[model samples]
Target: MGNALTTICATSDIHSPQYLELFKKALANSTCKPDLFILAGDIVEHNNIAEYRRVLELINSVHPGIPVAAVFGNEEYVGSEKEYVVRYPNVIFLHDNYRVIDTLTGRIVAVGSRGALDKPTQWQAKNMPGLIKYFRDLPDKISSLISQAASTNLPIILVTHYGVTYRNLTGENPAIHPYLASRRMENVIVNHRNVLKAVIHGHAHNGLVESIDIDSVKVYNVALPARGRIIKVEV
Candidate 1:
């Protein structure tokens, strides 16, 4: 295996101008401009599609051609249905689905959902969509994509909007801990441990950028407050 692909990652609770500036600075200072620019979710506070469009426009301005894989967070909830607007060429929103991007070294499979962590216990993933329903029906939807990703036998990078384990749940209220992350996510992810090389998520601002080896698959919390950060994963 050679060195993994490099990319920038950051989580946002709500949209702010400060984030756009930080992204420019990161791009200016970095020796290698990220191949992929990832937004973990909660792009804007209000469900206003206009604001979402504006943010996406700004993001495209900063990193003109880089592919950005993003998911919506709970706060992005506006009235009823989830927002689905794809104007920017680089912006790819992963909701109840995944996308495959072919690369030179190998293929990269990116799976994400806006409200994925609200499922039932780890043991109840099979019923995650029906009876054990909580948040996004990702656990059920991700099965086919994961199977295809693993079938390729390439190093896969899982981009998500929610933390999979409590290791990244530090400095959060104990009362809302369960609400922030669910054990069902850990189960669904661990089931395809062989395919996934790493998992990155947000929604926990004070949480640490930590990694845990679940049956050898590494999960990372990529949220860095309101700033921009970079990460490179090797196959």
Candidate 2:
């Protein structure tokens, strides 16, 4: 067998106190302790500072010393509070950046992007259509980051708030597909399949918890509503 690291716990869209409790209980009851905890996105319902702090505090209280990494969701716009979360001793907030953590298996690198969408669907097509243009370049930026990470020759995990592959949006409305993910980002992951361990994303709460392999790289949709349990992935 290949050198695979076991038990990287990933969860997303934790918006309620109950969901936060779910993580605490899951960790306590887990058969294998997680090497890393990845909060893909939407940790807070509306980017509430208190909620963000509560989640971090809960993780620290329940599973202290575990490395926690996160990316912000659409609900959480760029702000100082987003920066504040990373100040916690054990927290690493990834906003269009990457982090490398050493594990028994080897060096594992995680790259993140809040990511961008293609276009809104008819049902949700309103607001600032013009704004979509502003974020049009995000996919390219993410692609470059992933490429840089791959050059490190480390096992890579891509975490994002937006879906990368369309398969992750399987359970959502077909009309809203464009708005939920980025095809360009998926293309990058597909191109760099050799170094990619797994890709995890949220924002499609009603989406599938299934894993679809793109050239041997596994992509998971770990939104809380889609996968209630903390997803364990061997890197």
Candidate 3:
């Protein structure tokens, strides 16, 4: 028989207090015992930070002690990141950063971020004007992180809140594809295909294509509303 695969259970866009029950049901019904649990982003609704605890509790009840990693989503909002980190010291909140997880199968590097958008949304443009520059600089920051992660010689898994490629954004309006995800981010992933293994992301509620491959790296849109179940990925 082939060697056992390292399983990762991933999901996102819980929008807590809205889809929390659905998320609970999905996790309860899952049969896979994941080596790692990943929350791609938007765990809480409108920065209702307290609800994050409920989500974490549910995960712990189902699979305790597994490494949990997450990136920030737009709903998580700005200015509240440190609070989330302080509250859940256990969760690896990767905001343009990376962490390494050692599993029975092997060690995997997880690079996490809110991701970027090719064009700012109208709301963002009107409010967070500074985001234009931030988004412009994000790909390079993420690329550097991936490059550093590669130095470890471990398979790298990218976890982001925003979609990385338009290929997986089907069912959403093509005209706003730039607002949903970034081709620049896609370029970064493609550039590091030599070491990157898989990419997980959310924020595409209507995304019809849940998974796609860009030149070998697998990309998964794990938004809870889109999948209706927790995604189990074996690596």
List all candidate RMSDs to the true structure: 5.2, 3.1, 1.8
Q: Which stretches of candidate 1 lie over 4 Å from their true place?
A: 1-10, 17-32, 53-62, 78-84, 103-106, 118-137, 226-235
Comparing 1 and 2 on lDDT, the stronger one: 2
Model 3 lDDT, residue 223, Cα: 97
lDDT of each: 0.60, 0.75, 0.91
User: What TM-score quantifies how close candidate 3 is to the native fold?
Assistant: 0.95
Cα lDDT, model 1, residue 88: 40
Error of 3 at 17 (Å): 0.7
**Model 1: lDDT of residue 89:** 45
Residue 132, model 3: Cα distance from true site in angstroms: 0.3
lDDT computed for candidate 2 = 0.75
TM-scores for the candidates = 0.74, 0.85, 0.95
Backbone clashes for every candidate come to: 2, 0, 0
- At residue 85, what lDDT does model 1 achieve? 45
The window of 10 residues in a row where model 3 has the poorest summed lDDT is 1-10
Ranking by TM-score: 3, 2, 1
Local accuracy of candidate 1 as per-residue lDDT tens digits, 151-192: 665566676666677755767766566656766678767888
